[model samples]
Target: MDDTLTSTLELAADWADRFAELTTDERRQLALWLEESPENAAAFARMRRLMSDTALIDAFDKGDAPVQPLAPLPELRAGSSRPARADRRKPMLGRRQAIAAGLAGALALPFAGYWLAGGQTAGSPPPLRFASRVGERRRFTLPDGSGLLLDAASRVAVDFSEGRRHVLLEQGAARFDVRHDPARPFKVRTPHAGMVALGTSFSVDHLAEASELRVFSGRVRLDVADQETRVVPADRWALVHGATVSTGSFDPTTHPDWQSDWLDADAMPLGFAVQRLARYSAAPVRIADPKLASLTFSGRFRLDNPRQSLELIGALFGLRLEKRKDALYLA
Candidate 1:
């Protein structure tokens, strides 16, 4: 019943808000704090469990129960800066006793959100695992009889269940050829948008943490949380970020080309293309002049021979290509 226990719980809640935003230094400090006392770590773990349990409750109440490839509790919800309501005048219960009391309601496990030490608590949602890297294209048949093509440096996770087909694109771009399932719709989650498909083929590109969804065929209802929903017609695209959604017509053919094994680009920045092409080479590639990074290029090159391509590109641009320690240098 000491006041110290109460302060520890309050501090744990404060740290939950920061887990996502903390800089490396702050995170290091947190590590030190946790290491300083076993009690501190225990309290933090309890707070995290509570946060997650609350999220599950919220998700269920809202009827958004996550399906397929169940995710660990999502990273703490955004804008959850509100403090836990507590009676300021109430006496602090013993740490062990308080946690014990919260444990008795087994049916409320999802709602209680408390767990013993060493159990899972909400953490960074694992970045969607991908089978491809930057500038590389990959194709895989999904479990739901659909097709998936992952673009360069893209990451995504798929979950096919009895009720829904959910895909989370952690980063970069991907094209989905979703099979028709009127009873169970296909959904794709990006940081900035949620796209629901009504039996269709579409591609979604998430750039710089922004979202752009393009439907090649069929229809997609794009929702930007709490914002107006938008219907993206076939062959058109919707660009969404934060709470804004802008619709425009774009050729799906022009999106990132994963069909090409080599580098396939259309008006990609010269510097970025160089960076990507560098991956195929034995040595690292460097641009000697900062100004060279500003140049843009559009073309497809076989990545198998990065050195040869570098030489060709260098000749075209009147630049020099230097190879050193597994890198190409554009001087």
Candidate 2:
């Protein structure tokens, strides 16, 4: 093999072993590398298939297989037949190849409340669920190169089957930077809305009474019950409440800053802003004056210090803050 092919295969093997464990930045690097060339994507796919093959996993489990280095994978071209096997002699697996295979096999074992009741087939991996508590955030990448940034008080379920990537946003908010695959559409399903993206970066915020979809780049098709599909383009958003779909503009810079550990409000209602801050607050925030709830305020507050945030809000809005045993009241 040439130097380029050898390097590509090595990188593929490395990713196969540590894909699930990669940080958000590391996953972004891998995604950019994959987008650099069609050949890279194909090579990575081949490496993943070899690593996940059940026959190799079974052989590894039995521990009686011949100890030989793995043969170099044949170079494949689009629409061309796979090269025939070199010979019947089994080659020993390389260290990286061995590690990838071992990891794949180990992942097949049941995880706590992650796997379905029945065992999953060898070809299909079990669904993985992720969640973040109040004031906490999480970031991870899916198998298909898509990345997710889950905000505070959020939960998501990810499933990648043969031809689709499905994600269920149970609550709170998440941002998705999706990898484009025409063969498989990335779909995010929320309680009040569903979004389908061919390739896009977007955010979904699901609250108790409504859901919001924001498109930062590319286009998204939003569907609400019995309503016409709303196609939202870049720098736009839609709010879905019951069966109503309301579209609006969103400036990326002025958007909520929860991902950056800040709550940003641009002339947002005081009640709504307080509710948003409550997600990161240690104590409940109450508005003693009902008339003060609709007062609009614009500002950015740090999520790490809820008390300070409340203080800033009080100073800005000229409201009085009262500390109680059960809650912080602002009148």
Best by lDDT: 2
Write one digit per residue (lDDT tens) for candidate 1, span 181-289: 7877889998788899977888886664367777889899998888877788898877675566767675556543333445555545566566556544546677888
Candidates in order have lDDT scores of 0.61, 0.71
| Segments of candidate 1 deviating more than 4 angstroms | 1-130, 133-136, 208-212, 224-227, 238-256, 260-331
Measured by TM-score, how close is model 1 to the native structure?
0.45
lDDT of 2 by residue, 1-331 (tens): 3455555555566566567777876666677767776656765665564554334555666774443333444433333333333454335665556656444334333322322224234455545566776787877667788888888777787777668889999877899999999898999999898999957999998876678888989999998989888789999888786767778786787665676777777665687667667777767888888788778788788878877887889888787778898999886
In candidate 2, what residue range of length 10 has the lowest lDDT sum? 108-117
Off by over 4 Å in 2: 1-126, 253-256, 286-297, 314-320, 329-331
Clash count for each candidate, listed in order shown: 9, 7
Residue 327 displacement (Å), model 1: 4.7
